[model samples]
Target: MEEIKLEKGDFRKNIAVAGLGLIGGSCTKALRRTKTGKIFGIDIDSGVLDKAAGCGAIDDGAVDAQAILQKSDIVIIALYPRETIEFIKDNAGHFKPGTIITDTCGIKEPIIEAAIKYLPKNVEFVGGHPMAGNEFQGFDAASPELFFDTNYIITPHDRNSGEGIRVIERLAALIGCRRVTRVEARAHDRIMSLVSQLPHIVAVSFANLAVGEKDMSVFMGRSFMDVTRVSVLNRELWTQILEMNNSNIIDRIEDMIDILQKVKNALSEQDKNSLQILFDNAVKGKRMCLY
Candidate 1:
């Protein structure tokens, strides 16, 4: 872990972002807004790259990932879980030595493992997950303010260099994230399973159940809309995330199911005492979250 000094002044280095969808497009736009770097976008879909260019999200767009990697000082991966690994394995050799690489993957453990196993030792691959997104996808949904006032988590492994982590932290700050927290990859995945992945699963399930029933529309209200808002998220993206973090997600799901069973039993037995106990515990736990 060498300590590399970041140059002060305008960060004019060329940044290549793979996958010109919401996350990549937002990153490019944010970097451009900072006037810090020249942004280049790469996507497997030429249409997405074209759209990103048309939106002025990047200085240039290319379908050839290797070419983008060859010219980039930093590479930001904003692809799906499997695609992110494949992109790194496919184009990592093309990256310049000492180039800083980061990703916006939801889960961290698998990505970090892939980076360690596939990427060149000289290139720095830091795990970054910006805890911000809308229920939309594609370049059209991108906003420079996507990361603003958000919390960006940097999951650094033992192999990660301090300088690499700092570079990622600075990038989060540059994108206007209010806080950056460093944690282990496994910790990140586990916590995210409970907080993000499980909630999304519940939301999708609720939406699916509601849609399957007759007269469901008549029962819908603002509360339903607020709860299931993320149910409208791109299924393809969510499928990737759910499958990638299946183990942790399944654990959380089982825990939630157990909790639900307790509630069901208490209600079925007409146990007001048990119901009150559960309600009290819920309120106490929620109160602790006020901080």
Candidate 2:
């Protein structure tokens, strides 16, 4: 593989970002803020391309990605998991040799597999996930500051070049990530199932419970709202996410159920002592996680 010439605080490479939705758009905006490289945007939506260019988040954009792939030194794919795979498969032939391709997919294992199988041998793929986002979706909801002080995770394969990993780490820092850590792809997915997927499941289920209760809206408070905020999920996107990572998520769900069962049993037995202990443990756990 050819070496990518990237210097500290200076990346003059042509960086093409495929998919200009929330994560992608926010990434583009953050990259533009760095003023380190020429950023190009790609989206199926012509209007989105215009909006991205109009905001100066991109030097240029196009619906056709082949042209951009040919010239780009780095490509950040921000499409959905399946779409990301398909995009690579469809455009595998066009990427320039030594182009470092990475993706912002929620689950890393499948994306890593797709990259290894479909991409050209000369093309490098680093699996990445930005642990930052809101319930909102699309470019209109994206903010350049979205990644500020957020955590970014990279899951690199053994075949990946060391420089390619370093380049992504630097990009994460430039985009305002407070920390950039690397983990194995399978471990990354399992961890996301516990921290990310389970939370969404709980939020959506709780929200649905509220929906079933008449007059629930008037009684809603901050705690309830906070717990259910992410329930306003993109169903299509989440369906795919849940399906793709169902095995891990299912294990997490069972673990959650066991905990909930303990809480239920304590309440049923009118054991105030057990309830207090459980609440205290939860409080301590929350405090411990505040790094």
TM-score of each: 0.91, 0.95
Report how far residue 188 has shifted in candidate 2, in Å. Answer: 1.0
* lDDT tens digits, residue span 191-254, model 2: 9998899999999999878866888878989999899989888888798899999999999999
Range of the 10 consecutive residues with the lowest summed lDDT in candidate 1: 1-10
Question: Mind giving the per-residue lDDT tens digits that candidate 1 earns over 141-209?
Answer: 889999998889999887888978888887888887878889899999999998899888888888988
**What TM-score does prediction 1 earn?**
0.91
Per-residue lDDT of 284 in model 1: 97
Off by over 4 Å in 1: 1-10, 287-290
- Score residue 94 of candidate 2 by CA lDDT: 90
Q: Which candidate wins on lDDT?
A: 2
Instruction: Candidate 1: give the clashing pairs.
Output: 11-36
